[model samples]
Target: MEASITFGDDALAARAAEAARELAAAGVPEALAAGDPTLWGPAAESQAADRLGWLDLPTTSRSLLPRLAELAERAREQEVEHVVLAGMGGSSLAAEVICASADVPLTVLDTTDPAQVRRVLADRPERTLVVLASKSGTTVETDAHRRLYERAFRDAGIDPATRILVVTDPGSPLEQTGIESGYTVVQADPRVGGRYSALSAFGLVPSALAGADVARLLDEAAEVRPLLALPEGNPGLELGAALGAAALAGRDKLVLDASLSATTGLPDWIEQLVAESTGKQGRGILPVAGGEPTGVPDEIVAGIATDGAVRADGPLGAQFLVWEYATAIAGRMLGVDPFDQPNVAEAKDGTARILAEAGEGPLPTGAPVLVDGPVEAYGDLPADVKDLSGALTWLLSAIPERGYLAVTAFLDREAAFEVPVPPDASFEVLTDIWAAHDAATLQGLLAVRTDRPVTFGWGPRYLHSTGQYHKGGPQDGVFLQITGDVPDDLPVPGRPYTLGRLQLAQALGDLDALRGRGRPAVRLHLTDREAGVRHLLAAAREV
Candidate 1:
C-alpha cells in the first residue's frame, strides 16, 4: 500500500506545511471525515452536501467490492469479450486507466467523433458489451453515443438489450430506459459526484469488467484513507496544500510528470478533477497534465512514480484517493466550491440553445478567411504567408511571458486526410495518417521557435478534459482552434443537427466561452484537411 509523491523543493514543502495549517484551522479533514458540508463553503447545506459521499468511499468500498466482482464474473460467463464504455469525463477516465492495465479488453468511447464511433461499432459488435455511464443519466454526449450504438447494434442484427448495460444513479432516465429495454442496469451511489466516483461503482464496475483486482484496489485505497483522516503529514492534505499555496503565490501551473509505466490516462483524469474542481470565480489552479515541464517561474512539478514491473491497479487506486482528497482540501484553501462547475454549464447550455434553434439560421460561425485549398487565414498579416505563417505569428504573439499555447483541433483524426486506404487496414496505418495531420510537428516548432511550452488538445474531447483549465484556470493560455469540413456528416438519429454540426457548435461555443473570459484565442478553418495540415507544417518551418 506504499505510494510515492514528493514535493518539488524546500520552498514548496514549506508552503505545503503552511497550507496544511490553514486547512487544519478551517477543519477541512475533520469536516470531510464527519461528512460535514462546511468544508465546501456556504452552499454546503444544499444538494451539494448530499453529493459528498465520495469523501468516505475508501472506507465504504468493502461492501461494494463483492458485487462488482460478481458483475465481472457475469460478463465473462456471458462471453462478453470487449467492453465499450460510453461516457465522458469522470464516468470514463478511470475505466480507461484500468483497461490500460487489465486483462479484459475495454474501449472507452468518450468522443462523439463519427469515425471513432464507427471504429468501436465495427470491432466485434456481437461480443462487445456497451456500458453507458453517466451520473446525471442525461449527459448529451453519453446519450448521443447510446443512440448511435443502439442503432449500430440493431443494424448488425444484434439485440441492443443483450449488448448494452447501464451504469447510473437510481431512478435516472437511463436506469428506467434500461429496465424498459431489458438491458442490465447497475445503479451507482447517488451521493457520489461524477469526478469523485472513481472509487465507487462508476469506476469499480468498469475495472472489474476489465478483470482488474478490484479487492486489492480497494485495499490500497483503504490504506490511504487513514492518512487522509489526519491533518499533519497527511499525504493528501500536504499535496493539496502545496498545490493551493503555489497557485495562490502565482505558480498556478501544476506540471505533472507521471512515470511512463504508470496507468494510462492517469494525468488526463487528474487534469479534469483539479481544473474542474478548483478553477472558478476568476481564480484557479491550472494542472498541466502529461505535458513537458515548462520550467517557468509559475510552474510546480509533481512526479508520480510507479514500480515499472508491477500492474498499476493498486498504485492507481491510491493515487486516485490522494488527488480526490487533495483537491477537496485545495478547494478549501482557494475559497471556491469544489463540487460545482459553474462555467462547464455555460458551454453545455450554449450547445443546447444552439441545438434548439437548429433550423433558425446558419450555426454560429467565427469564419477564418480561406487562403487556399483547406487552408485559412485568421489574423491580418502579409499576403505571402497568410495561410500559415501569418496565423502562427498572430498565435505566437498572443502568448504572454511564461504562458503556453493550446492548439485545440476539432478535426476528426480518422477523416482528416484525402487519401483512401483499405477497409482492413491496421490502426498503425490510421495513426500514421493522423500523425501526418497532427500538431506534434507544429508543437515542436512552436516550442523551439517561441521557447514556450505548447499543448495540443483535440476539440470536443478536450472540452470535456482540459476545457475547464482553458476557461476557468489562470488567464495565461493563448488558444488556437483548428477545425475543418467533414467529408461526410453523420446526422443524430432524431435531432435536427448532425454530429458534424454538433462538433462545430461545440467548437464555436468553447471559442466564445474562452473569448468571453478574455483569454486570447483565434480560430483557423481548414478547407482541405490534408493540404491545410501541410501548410501549417510549412508555416512552422518558417517560424
Candidate 2:
C-alpha cells in the first residue's frame, strides 16, 4: 500500500526544489535520521533528545508488537464492549484515525464540553474500558475527564479500577494515579511528544485495543523509513520543503485533500500535527482540511491517496510517519521549534487565572450591543435583521486582504439548537445548526465578502488543533468567538467549577490570548442559542 504525493501547482514544485537544496546543504535529512539535536537550530542544546524518538517509531514499534497483541487479546477476553480514550491533540487524534478502521467500538473524547462528557458517560460504564492518555500526565482536560468518569463509575456501583487503563510516560503523575487506583498502567516513551507519538505506545495501545492490525501498520511505516533518509528523493523531506517554501512565499494555507473512505479523520489529525508543530514565532502553516476550497491565490493543495476505495491495509501508519517527518523538516525550514509549545501555555495560564478569580457567584455577563467594528454582543440582540446585519457587515468589512476569518463556537453541543422552529421557516435545520450555517452560508458569505478563506472551528476542540497557529503564527486572522449559556450545566465531581464554566473559561482564555497578541477578535454571547444562530444566518443572507 504505497502512497503518492504531488503539488497542486508549478509554484509549489519550484519551491520544493529550492527547499530541497537548502535542506541538503544544512544536512537536515541526515541529522533527522540520525536523531541529531542540530535539527532544532540554535535551540538544539535546549531541546530534548527523546523528542526525536518518533523518527524511529517504525523500528521501535516492531519491538512492542507482542505486547500490543496481548493487550488486544486481554480486552477481547474481558469482553470490553467499548474502548473510550480520554485525551487531546497528539495523544488521541492518531488513535482516532486508527480506531475508525478497527472492528472494535472505540470513542475518543477530546472535548471539554459537558454535553460531550455526559454522552461518553452515558455509555455502558461496566462494559467500557476508559484509557486515560496524556503524554505530560498533567493535561487539565484529561485529568478532569478522568475525575468525572471515575465518579460516574462509582455512582453506577462499578469499581473504575477494574475498567480503567492509563497510558503515559513512566513515573508521570497519571501513571502513579493509575497504579494508586489499581488500574492497569501502560508506560509510553518519555521522549515522544503527543502529536508525534502515533507510532509510539500512546497510539498503539488504543489502536490494538480497538482491534487494528498494529503489526502491519508498523511494517508499512518501516518500509517508508528508508526513503526519508535521503534529502532529495525523500517524500517527507520534499513535502516538508514544499510546505516551508510555501509559507515563506506567503502561501501559508496548506489545504489537504484526503479520501474519506481511505483516510477517515486523517485530515483532522494532520491538521493538529502541522498546525501545532510548525506554527510559532509569527510563522506557521495553516492546515485546511475538508473545507470548502476558497481558491485564493495564497493557497497550496496537497492530496493523500490510499490503497483501497473503502479500506486500506497501511495508509494510516504510512501517513503518520510521512507527516511526522515532514513536519519536523518544515519546522527546520521555518526556523521554529517543532517540539516546544510556547504559546499553548498562555491559554492554560489564562484559564488558571480565570478559575482562581471565579467564586460561588453566578458567571459574569455583559450587555448586548451593535457597533461599527467587530460586534461584541452579550445575550440576545434585537431580532430585527437590520441591526444584526449591520454588525455582521462591519465584521466582514474588517477582514484585510490576504487575511482569514475564524468562527469559534462555544455553545453546548448537546442542545445547541433544540428550539421550537419550523422546518421550512428558512432552511432545513440539522442537529448542529451552527455547523450547517458555517458550511452552507457563513463560509461562502465571508469568502465572497473578504475574498479570503473562511474557517469554522468548534470551541476548545480547535484550541488543540488550530489554536497554536492562531496565536503563534502570522497575526492575520479575524477571530469571531460565539459563546452561549448552557440550559443545564453539569458540575465536575468534587470541583468548584462545572463543565460549562470550564468550557467557557477555555473559550475566554483563548480569546484573551489572541487579543493579547493584538489579533483582531470579537465575542458574541447568546442567551438563546437557537435564536442567535438564526440571527447569524439571517445576517449572512443579507450579505
Candidate 3:
C-alpha cells in the first residue's frame, strides 16, 4: 500500500521534488564526475555513494510492526504502566521515537544520574517494566540502568529476573545478562549496526510498548525505502547524502528534532551513525540533540569573532540561502565511496571493553553527580571550574571565528520560578524558576541579533510541545543545554531507592530527551547554588 501523503499541498511537494532531484544528482557519484572533472572527483566518489546505498538495504521494515504489536500485547498482559529503556545511542533512539509519538507516557534513561534513579524508583509502580537495550549487549549507560532497575526490583520484593526485558543480538553481553538473570530476552539483527537498528526490533518493540502506532511507522518507513532507492525525489537518501556532502564541504553540524520521550536517544545514535559512516579523515557531521520549542537554535551568527568583529570573507560570508541552495547543488560531494571513520568504531569498542571488565555480567558505573565534561570541550573551560565565572571567561577567550555559542544553566526550583519567558503556548508549563534563566538567556542572544527571534523553554516541561514543531519545524537552529547538579538528590522515602541513585536516573531521563532531538547540545553542569545565578549572568555577556 502506498503511504498516504498529507499536508495537502501539491505545490510544496512539487517544489520539494524538483529540489530533491538536483540534490540526489549532486550527491550521486556518476552525475558529479561528468565531462567537467572539476564538478566531481575520480573513482573514490562513485564507490562512496555506492556504499551509502545500503541505507536502503531493508526495502521494507515489515517485521518490526508485528513485533511491536506483540510487545504491546505483552505489556498489556503484564499491565505495565511505564517502561524505562536503558541503552545509549541507537539502541535507544527508536524507543524514543515511539515513546514521544505514542499516546502513552514513557521515559528513557541514558545516563548514570543519581537523581534520575531516585525519581524512577519513586515513580515506578508495581507494574513498571524495564527494557535493557544494548545491541552488542555492552553499553555502560544501558548496563548501569539495568543494574539500577534490577536492584530496585530485588529491594521491592519483586523478582529481578521477572521484572526486566532484554533486547540485544543473540549471544551478546546483554543477552547473556538476561539469560543468567532469568529475564525475558529478544534478539536484534546481527547485521545491523546500532545506528541502523532503529528499523529493527531494537527500536520498534519498545516504541510499541510505549503506545506508538508502530504499524503506521513501519508503513511510513517502507514507503521511504523505495523512494530513497530511486535517488530522485527521495527525501531520506537525498537528505543523508546532502547532509554528508554538507559535512564534507564545511558545515560540520546537523541538529535534529524529536519528541522528549521517544527521541531522547537519537543524538547518540545519530552521532554514531554519521560519525562512523561519513566522518572520514577529519570531517564528519556532529549530530546533537534538542527538544521542541526549546531546542531550536534561536540564531546562527556565522562571522562573530572573538574580537567582536564580523567578517564577511570566504564561506563565512555565505548566507542561509546559499547553504540551502548548496544542499541541492552539491549533493553527496564525497562521491560514491565509503568514508570509514575508525574513531566511531573505536569509541564503541572502548565502551564495550569497560563493560566487559565488570565481574557482574551486565554491570555499569552506578549513578554519579556528574559525568566528565564533553569529550570535545574538555580543556575548553578553565582549570578552576567552581562556578560560571570561569566558563564565561573561557567562552570569551576561545570564541569561534564564526560559530554558534550558547549558555546552559541549571537553576533550582526557586530560581527557575523567578525567570521570565515568551508568550508562546509551549512555555506555559515552565515554572517561573526555569523561565527566569531561559528568558534572560534568550534576551541576551537576541541582543546580539535583534533581527532573529529566539526560542527557549524548561526541561521536563517543554516536552509536550515536541510533536508538530520540532521534527516538523524549519531545521536551522542551534541548542545549548543548561542544567544544575542538584545538591540534595531526591530519593524514594524508606525503600531501596537511594537518593544518589534516583538523581542519576532522572538526570539520565532529562538528558536522553534532549539528546534524542539530534542537535548541537552542550551540557553546563552547575556546581553550586550560586552557580545558577552566575550562569545566567554569564549568558548575558557579549563575547
Candidate 4:
C-alpha cells in the first residue's frame, strides 16, 4: 500500500533532481504542507486558500465511514444493491477507480448522449440506488441527469427521496434542491477542489455504496500522506518535479502506460486532474491515455506500467493522494492556479448560445463539406480530397510538430463490438480490433501516421474534464469531433430539446469554441453508427 517513485532515465532523473533542489531551496514542500496559500503568489492566494483542504482528506474523511456504511446497508436491505452514479469530473472519477479496483459494479452516467442515458434507464430502477453528485449543483449535464433520473424513479412508482442520494458542497445549489426534494445530501469539504476530492465524501460515498473497502483506502492514503511533506524524499514532490521538468523540457504530452493500473483506469482520472489543473494561460500538460506511443518526440511516458521514470505504484488511495499532490506541485511550477478552470465556460456559453438560437427550430448542425457513405465531413477540407482516406490525411497533416490531435466521440462508449477473430487469428488480434471498433480507433491509427500525440474521449463527459485544457492550454492543438445520427432520439422529460439534439449541440458548441480560438477543428458526422464506425476504422487505418 506504500506509494513509491523512481527514475528510469538520466534526463528525467537529472531534471527532476534540479527541480527538487529549487523547490526544496524555496521551502515549497513545507509551505504546501503548512497550508500556506501564498506559495502560489498573490494572484492565486485567495483561490488556493479555498482549495487546499484535500491535503487533510486522507484522515479527515474517516468520519464519513459510519454514514457510508449505513447507506450501503440500507440499500442492501431494500434489495437495491445496484449503484448508479450520476456525476461529472472528479466527483465520479475517484469512485469509479475505487469500485473498479474492488471488482464491484458501478454504473456511471456522465454523458448527454441519449443512447447512453436510455441504456441506464433500462437498468431496473426499483433495484437501483442513484447518487446525484455535482459540486456546484448546476452542471448542465449533471442537472439534466438528475431531472431524468428523478422522473425515471417516479415512473417506477418509487419515491426518488428514498432511492436517491446527493453529494455536493454545503450551500451549493444541489444541496438546497436535495433538501427541498427530501433526499439524503452529503455535504463535502468546500475547500477541496473537484479534481482533488478523491479522498473526500465525493469519492467515498458512491464507492462505499458499491461495496469498495472505503476505510482501507483511507488507511492506505494515511500511511503515505506524511511523506508528502518532505521536499526531497517526498514521493509526491519527486513526481511533481519530474512532471514539471518534462513539460518545461518540451515533452509535455504524457502517454499513460496502463500496465500498472490494469482495469482500474487510473490514467483516465490522472488525465483530467493534470490537464485541468495545469492547462491555463496558453500552457498545460496534455495527458495521452495510452502506452508509450512511438515517434512523438514531445511525448513523456508515465503511469503504472513501463520502465518510465515518472511512475506510481501503490493502492488506490495512496495513488490518488500522491497524484493530487503532484498535480498541485506541477501547477505551481507551471505558473498557473491549479484550483481554477478559466476557459471551461467558453464551451458552456457556446452550448447555451446555440441552444438559445435554436428557438423552436431544429438544432444548428452546420452543413457538411464532403459526404461519403455513412460519413459526412464538416469544416473546410483540403481541396481535391475525394474520399475518407484523403480527408483523414488532410486532418492529420494539420497537426503541428509539438501539437496533438484530439478525437471526441458523441456515442455510446459501452456499445458492444463483438469482433469475430478468424480461425487463424491470435487473441491479441481480436482484442486489438475490438478496440478500434469505434471512433476511438482514430487515436491509435492517427498516432502511428503522424508524429504527434493523439487523444480520444467520449464526449460531454470530457467537456467537464480535459475540455478545460483543449481551449485554454497550448494553442497548437487540432481537433476532430465525431458525432453520430442517433437511431432514436429521446426527448428530455421537461426540456424542449431531445437528448440527441443536446449532444449535437454540445459537439457543435465545442467546434465553435475551438475554431473561434483559431484552432483547426473538423467534425465527422456518422450517418449510421455501425457502418460509420467501420468506415471510420478503415479510413483511419489508411491515414
Best by lDDT: 4
Tens digits of lDDT, candidate 4, 173-226: 999999999999999999999999988998999999999899998998999888
- What is every candidate's alpha-carbon RMSD to the true fold? 3.8, 4.4, 11.6, 2.1
The TM-score of candidate 4 is 0.96
Return the top candidate by TM-score.
4
Residue 183 shift from truth in candidate 2, angstroms? 1.0
For candidate 1, write residues 1-543 as lDDT tens digits.
475446548787788788788778877777776778776657655756777898678777668777777777777787988888998888988877776755456788877666657677788887788899988898888888888888988998989998888899998998988899999888888988888888888888877887777777677777777767677757787778878888888787776666654566677788888888887776787766546665678777776663211112238778888888788878877888888777787778778777677675788674555465557655334345555676687778878986778888877555444456668879999777666666555666676677565777776767776777677766778988887767767767866777778887887778778888677777878777667787777777877
Model 2 spans with C-alpha error above 4 angstroms: 101-104, 259-261, 306-314, 370-386, 412-445
lDDT of 3 at 37: 28
Give the worst 10-residue stretch by lDDT in candidate 3. Answer: 308-317
**Selected candidate, larger TM-score, 1 vs 4:** 4
When sorted by lDDT, best at the front, the candidate numbers are: 4, 2, 1, 3
Instruction: Give per-residue CA lDDT, model 3, range 322-437, as digits (tens).
Output: 22222223233444222322333332343334434643342232333223332112122345643343443444434343233333322332344434556673645565446444
Clash pairs for candidate 2: none
lDDT pick, better of 2 and 4? 4
Angstrom error of the Cα, residue 423, model 4: value is 15
Would you list the clashing residue pairs of candidate 1?
374-527, 374-528
Candidate 2, 380: how far from true, in Å? 16
- Residue 96, model 3: lDDT of 70
TM-score of every candidate? 0.90, 0.89, 0.60, 0.96
Better of 2 and 4 by TM-score: 4
Per-residue lDDT value at 393 in model 2: 65
